[model samples]
Target: MATIQSQHKWRFFRSGGFDQVALDSAADLQHLSELDPKLWTVLNCPTTGLEFDCRTLALLDLDGDGQIRVPEILAAVRWSCERVLDAEIMFKAPGLPLSAIDDQDAEGANLKAAALRVLEITGKTEADPLQVTDLADMTLLFSPHHFNGDGVVMAELTSDTELAQLITEIIQTQGGQLDRSGGLGIHGDSLNAFYQQAAAVVDWHAAADPADPLFCPLGDKTVEAVAAFEAVKAKVDDFFVRCQLAAFDNRAAEALNPAVAVYDVLSNKAISSSDKDVAALPLAAIAAGQSLPLGEGINPAWASAMSQFKLLVVDPLVGSKSKSKAGHLTADQWQQICDQLEPWRSWQAAKPDTTLHQLELERLQAIVAGDGKERLEALIAQDLAASTFADNVDAVERLVRYQRDLVTLLRNFVSLSDFYQRKHKAIFQIGTLYLDQRSCELVLKVSDMARHATMAPFSGCYLVYCTCERQGETPLQIVAALTAGDVDELMVPGRNGVFYDSQGRDWRAMVTKVVAQPVSIGQAFWSPYKRVAAFIETQLQKFAASRDKDIEAKTTTGVTAAATPASTPAATAAVAGFDIAKFAGIFAALGLAVGAIGTALAAMIAGLFSLVWWQIPLVMAAVLLLISGPSMLMAFLTLRRRNLGPLLDANGWAVNTRAKINVPFGAALTGLARLPAGAKRSVADPFAEKKRPWGSLLILLLVAVAAAVFWWFKLN
Candidate 1:
């Protein structure tokens, strides 16, 4: 095969201990496409941030598994090269119009049609070349607000009066021309300014008339009344204190003059009554003689004195006479006073009722009434025009994004082509590693490795190593897999054997490092069963060893006792005298155990026999499936997903392809033990014994007899 050569002199670069070529031109990309598919730098890669035409990649991923293989990439490049005017044209221009595309090819025709449709949607002339601006415009024109179910430019105001008022407010609040194009559109910066200005206008109007319309007369009256009641309460308390003192002392009332007496007591008649009571009481008793009592309802003289004083003083001072009369405040009287003062208490307590809404409505009405309406209308018109232009600009911006994405795709593919052309011998540019301990595999391309060399490698895969210890006499081996990264600094050969992954996560690993090949599913499938068998064999050997030791101990004791000649006779007799009952009991117990197991087996067989003939086979099949179905299914699935991606990803390579290692391919990747060429081994073993055919013949005869009996029973 003729090796492909690059038309342009490729610039060389070093990354991750490998030589790399810079893909700077379309010719470099074309030369790469001509090289062997294996020589391509990457097979499968995540398209997340890398620019590549999604449609092209989709075409390249033949299996639709979101990965593009070398063959797929090569095929796509070849197809495009054959059809397009120049594959490089994609990278040269920001975009091309539908007319620029060749209509001869199906792909070009479809793309052209799509571009034309985009132009139409954006309200651009059909002849106009499709650009990033056109795509952006289309997106904006179809946005929620502009293309809502309702007709374009829906009325912001429902009523003519409201519209006129809004216009007037806008004119007065924002006197300058509505420069929507200059950042005054709905989503523009000027809208914020507009709001601030509107708020200022409202504040000015409110300041001019500070009286709140929602303010209630009752609220003010309630406050005033509460203050008045507080003032009166102090005076009443002083009067009460003086009266109480006077009642206790006869000379206490003499201190109060006629002017002070009227203020203290509501009536002059109360004073006369008090004087009569004082005269009736003995002067010595009134002077608080030790035998005289002053308690109410207890002493007649004291009671008569208190009763007259209260009727003439306390009743007229604090007691309520009628609903209209207020001598002093009582609980009911106080409540009545509050109620009269504030009737809107309940309304006030429910929820706050601010007058801002009413104020705003008034401001709007005022703005609409004057000559400001015409100016406001003009401003609205200007704003609408600016909004239309802004929407177009947004569309253009979005279209530019699409262009950038396409440019990125072109750049990546072109670069890949250059790399391939320069490195023809790198057939396995993407390498695969298998880790038996981790049961993980990785397939890494050159680019993925370079990226991984960075401080923060991608998280998809990691390299890890650990020490594996065998439970028995086998020496420990260091095993590694695509499972750990540099972040796992604490990981060591022994200890917890923990390692960190590329994602900076820790994991306990049994492997030291990833290998070039891993154990296949066939080998893995029987590993557990083999381990169980080995364990059982070891246990049985240990049990046999223990039983032999016990027997040896007993023999040694018998020999030791026999060495004493005196006990020899008794020991021999004891050995010779076999206990028939004990023997019979031992046999009986053994028979019972055998019978129990046989009975259970018989019962199970009988149950199977009771089923219909066809059902018996099905039941047996179901039993077999129940035993091995999960194991087989798991093995099959594991085998299918056993790809080289994870292993490569761990090593910091971005595998863009499935790179599946099926059974046959897996076998090739990992070799099994085999005899060397021209090697010979002895067929005979020194311990081998001759076998007789009688036992086998007898077993076959018994099986035949059993089959005959079963057939006879079924016929009967």
Candidate 2:
């Protein structure tokens, strides 16, 4: 997402996530907007009333009741103890639930402080939820390769000069005999050519001489040859026709195979095509995920489980000292961690399955080495060997079962791990994105160029994604582009991109260019969190229900499953010592905080009315159109690009469920309005960038008073 940062810049700097409710902490006249510096000064703001839950960030009224305040201008004046450094992190991953990181800074400018920052910047806003479905989970997302393999060479290879010198010395001492035997095997193009020649010799077979000159060359009959050619042509036509008919017969045979029934089961209408979403694309599961077929990496059970939990991320968890706006974790540390996990996978692959005997089935797993890999390699080294023709022509009865079993096991391990790694890469962002729920499928599907990989500061590409961790009706795709500065371009979907869905389908996306700008890490991880959270919530609910049933069964009939998560408690605390009065006071204080600002706003309104004339509808239709016509047009264009009609259709489970996710301004604003409140539960504040000016707003208020005074004097 290096290129997706533009929207973040445009959002924080220009649009400022503006909304009406959070703008006027000190209540302003309705229908008016502005960035009031005074609003920044007083703690009391009626419009951006503080909510206890803190997910809702209040909107800052920067321009005295007309325009939103610029974040930079606010930061320049008074420090609002909100922004994390100067960057916006809270807005990126508000629900990350990172408590340890938050305690680092009291002023809340540290990386963890960003959650509060996003709110302080936005102030607060009241909103009617948009007429959209499943938007609460609107967050950024993407999949990148994160499950890294260990280094091949633990120690660096010797340099050419060192190798050459050693080789020369060896040759001088042993007259090159050592070099011929051990220094280097027959290799390079020369070795390849030798093998080719040997293979050619082994495969060479002389065809019987069809000409038969030994018996009949003296005949030399041209007229007879022409007649023979005509006969051959007729025979060739008949053969061609027979071959076509055979092709048709073969097709029929394949269709009738049991394999065809298996394919039908795989594509059964009962499974993916459910009544909940009949209009969804028949290939929705394909759209959800794609990797090697089953029997490659994991068992069918594991594959199905994984399909439910794949992800696609673009950046790495380890932050390099590269030119990135978001300060990421140390790359070397993350690499070390990546190295540590290698043995776990290797151990799983090298499970001693084949070694155990059937007699030990109750006590042990088999770990037998089938056909040794070394044996296969030895055969492959022979000149006569081609994978296509490695046949035991003498019918020596090769042990095919052992070799196949190991190969099959290795393949299954590789495919599942690779797919899981891809999924982890897509959604498991490093900075934030705490485990909203621990046990659910997180599938990541991304499409890139065929068999292509790109190197980053590390050996391979790493992708980090952040999304708005909100609830939604459907799954979404989030991406983030990293850069050193504020970006302004919008990033859209591109070709061979990855997407993860709710039902465990992770598929690569087929798209063209996705124009995007840099997005902060916080903005990238929100969607996955939302999905995981939803799944976890559901799981918890289901678990609770099951527990109730189990308890009932145990009490009534004394029957239960052998497995159990239920456990007895050691002790219980008495509730008699609880202080109700103190808790009530705390609640009262919270209520006062919300209402205090409204009073101040009422006073300000009274004062303003003493100076103003009347509601002349001076903001006439023409003037209103002039002020917002272009903006309205832009909004309209954005709606069309978002394609909510198609989205709504999909949500409705009507026809054509291939809906698009276009992050619209309204949707963003809604996310923004809820930002401050959302930040309270997450790791850090995401929106508090630079604070608005207190003096600027006070100055304006004083100036307005002076103007009203002057008007009264002139009338007198």
Query: What TM-score would every model get versus the actual structure?
Result: 0.29, 0.17
- After the best TM-score superposition of candidate 2, give how far the Cα of residue 585 lies from its true spot, in angstroms: 68
lDDT (10s digit) by residue, model 1, range 455-503: 2222222333344333453332222323221122223333344333333
Q: Please give the distance, in angstroms, between residue 40's alpha carbon in candidate 2 and its true position after superposition.
A: 55
Residue 59 error for model 1, in Å?
35
For model 2, residues 485-574, the per-residue Cα lDDT tens digits are: 212222232323343443334444333323232123223324344546789999999999999999897765433322433343321122
Compare the candidates by TM-score and give the number of the best one.
1
Q: Which stretches of candidate 1 lie over 4 Å from their true place?
A: 1-536, 565-585, 604-620, 649-659, 672-691, 708-716
- Stretches of candidate 2 above 4 Å error? 1-612, 616-625, 641-716
Q: Which ten residues in a row have the lowest lDDT in candidate 2?
A: 146-155
C-alpha lDDT of residue 85 in model 2: 30
